[model samples]
Target chain A: MSKVRERTRSPEGDLPAPTPDAKQWVVYTQKREGAPFKWAGTVEAVDTELALQYAREHYGLDEACVGLITYEHGDSVDGEYSIGPLVPQKADGTDGDEWLVFTLAKRGGNHQTAGTVNAPDAATAINRGTAAFADGKACNIRVVLASDVHETTDEEMVIWRTHDMTYKLAKGYSKQVRSKWTRIRDNPAYEQYQKEDIETHF
Target chain B: MQNMLADQLANIVLMHADDKLMLGHIQSDWTGLAPILEEDIAASAMAQDDLSHALVLYEFLGERFKLDPDAIAFDRDPCDYRCCDLVTIPDEFDWATSVVKRWLTATFSQLGLHRLATMTEGDLGDRAKRLLDEQTIQVTHLNRWMTRLGRGSIESHDRMQAALDRLSSSAGMMFEPPDATLTEDESFCCGRDELFTEWAKGIGITLDAAGLSATITLPDRSTGGGRRGEHAPHFIDQHAELTEVRHSDPATSW
Candidate 1:
């Protein structure tokens, strides 16, 4: 409650510093249940669990959101990477892996989840992505294979394990806006208006 | 009797709006100062929801009372506003306290809205239901934080406990009946007894989930007349801040 200790503390001072293991996670939010999940934004969390919480706070709070899905940045491979056989002279130019495609139709627009295309590599997936989903307005497109995803179980989430670090979770900041409020409430103008206000009422 | 009921209902609605407006103002103060960046944005978003709800309620009141929404909100004197003492509690700069306060207030608001939704029919009922929809996110956000802090680190648990202790006395003020006259209408959707019982049960469930005790008792209605047009002792400060811009150079529009 004392202002001295609370006021001067630094931001993120109590929270644990991000370790080298922290990774960026891309989040997709579905505004309502059964609605299309749109690319919302990104969050930097040490793990998927923290990413979910941060993603909820960052993007989910502003609107009527129902669902959120996060993908680790490293788990995804771009379709552009497999551009070797652009014009595949032979029939065997494609691999058999099914790559999921996503498209960013406009600048600053959310990347809609496009359907998947079976291809030999990431580059072929990009071509298939363009052919299947492109409407001539796509600014960027990405593709990732299904096999690269590393899903963590609930019991494995490390976000809940920081028992020694209380400061990071909730104790780092102190705000004094109401201290001035207390003084302002005791002003004579307020006292004067209290009586006058009653008179104005019918 | 009908006229009295109308007056009492309008007053009750205004009190609801007043509570939301003051809470919105206080929470907005945490916009840039929250303990964490994500929390800062979340707090601002919740504050926006509170203000938005207040705006809707004020507009509803305007329709009934034949007053402009702006006048209803900004032109009122300090003692005329009917916001609860819990929303006016001074910022102790403690994150746990802020989150806990939000949790408790949001819980009470949710229950009140539930009772309202079930009690009234037609326009008032529709508005209550709509406001309840918007409150879903705030309730979820606050509940999660309450649980996390309650069961998180030892320091967090202790801080949360201390905040509960500090806030327990006035938190019950939120459940106080709007006004004695309002409850005289048999058609009214809910009574104070039902509201208090539902609120206590809901809050107990939430607190118990957060690893905290569920021992809240109602405060005396006489002492909690924010709903009766009796402002808290510290309400003038909030009124000063609220009216400062509008009152300054009253000749020009802000």
Candidate 2:
């Protein structure tokens, strides 16, 4: 038989609907003052207050530390966008690594591009830094590799990998402490590489 | 100084802390699950705050009584629990009812603490005063949610009010005394003989009158003595769930 016999599952298999009882949401916890937000554990709730309450009880208690909880929401914009629908825009299934580039600016100045982030695709790369944006500006933008601007090599953009983001985060208390900040001031280079290697969408 | 007061304080603290522990777990179920992102975060934060509050009381009780906090917290059967009937009722997956319960409970507790703050003596008095300070924060947060839902949408108001009517009879349960194994002589807990009546008459009356009425039917606690280890089916179910994990390896670290 021709290739018409070939079959594949739909992308819908990857994303299941939220259950009526288990309301799942990403919780961003502020563990410390100046650190960038690291991914915290997920929790269930019926609504916003209930979700926050759940996060506080599960993550905030037992440890005599201060923390804040927020239902990690998805968003979109110019330089910023939600990490969803990881649509790999390739023809022949040849994909490599794409890095997310961020340039943190202060007072309207040219934000010296922070660093390149590893991503499977351009859109995926852009999402790793979206939650940091506040107003109309990309709180952080792209700095593709050694080149400090929004440059992307054809090889880097088309490359794909299954490198999950989970391995990079710490296991326990350290991860708990890492979830507080809005941005990364240190180790910009490493963060840049990470943006390209993984897919992070809410 | 008096042993009776000490026992009373222990009982009071145990009840308060136990309620917080359970509610804290229940409240945490909402994390990342709320209808709105903003409200989700805010509510989660309060859950952490409540747990923190419980920890303080638990620690105090543990230290004063020379007992392990976890023992008192996880080891007790629901029948042995002294928490009022108000906190025992299941939220039944209803968010509005949960909020109303918290609002009403906090109001009643705040009143209890308020009266305690005026005590001319005793460490319990001092602790109550301190708790009162923190309790206000919870009171404000809960009250805000209630008013928001109460005044904003007609549907919201109706949902909350209906839940209130269904659970209205349990409000008085908060003031009722259990048949607690704790006695004035045992250094367990005290003052419940008339504390519920006094608290209702003194503070509850004002709160009920001040636009917070939903109708509270005080449980006839005299019929069943929970404080003395006589619990109903609801409590047994609760204890089974809460203790299942803890008893798995009681002597080991969780």
Query: Candidate 2 regions off by >4 Å?
Result: A1-202, B1-6, B115-127, B179-213, B217-230
> Per-residue lDDT tens digits of candidate 1, residues B1-254?
22322476666676677878988887777777886676677677668778878888777777766776777788877756767778888765678878888888888777766656664523676777777755765776677778877887787888898889988888777766666544523313555666678778877877888888745777664554666557666677668877777788655642
**Against the true structure, what is every candidate's RMSD?**
13.1, 18.1
Q: Residue B171's C-alpha lDDT in candidate 1?
A: 78
Interface RMSD of each: 11.5, 20.8
**Winning model by DockQ:** 1
Stretches > 4 Å off in candidate 1: A1-23, A29-40, A45-69, A81-100, A104-111, A116-202, B1-6, B119-122, B184-188, B220-223, B249-254
lDDT of 2 by residue, A1-202 (tens): 2121122223444543443554575544434444333335666655565455555445544332234434423221125332332222232322445342443443343333233445556555555434332223434453232221111122212111111123223565456456533244356776776776565531
Query: What is the CA-based DockQ of model 2?
Result: 0.02
**Alpha-carbon deviation at A114 in model 1, angstroms:** 0.5
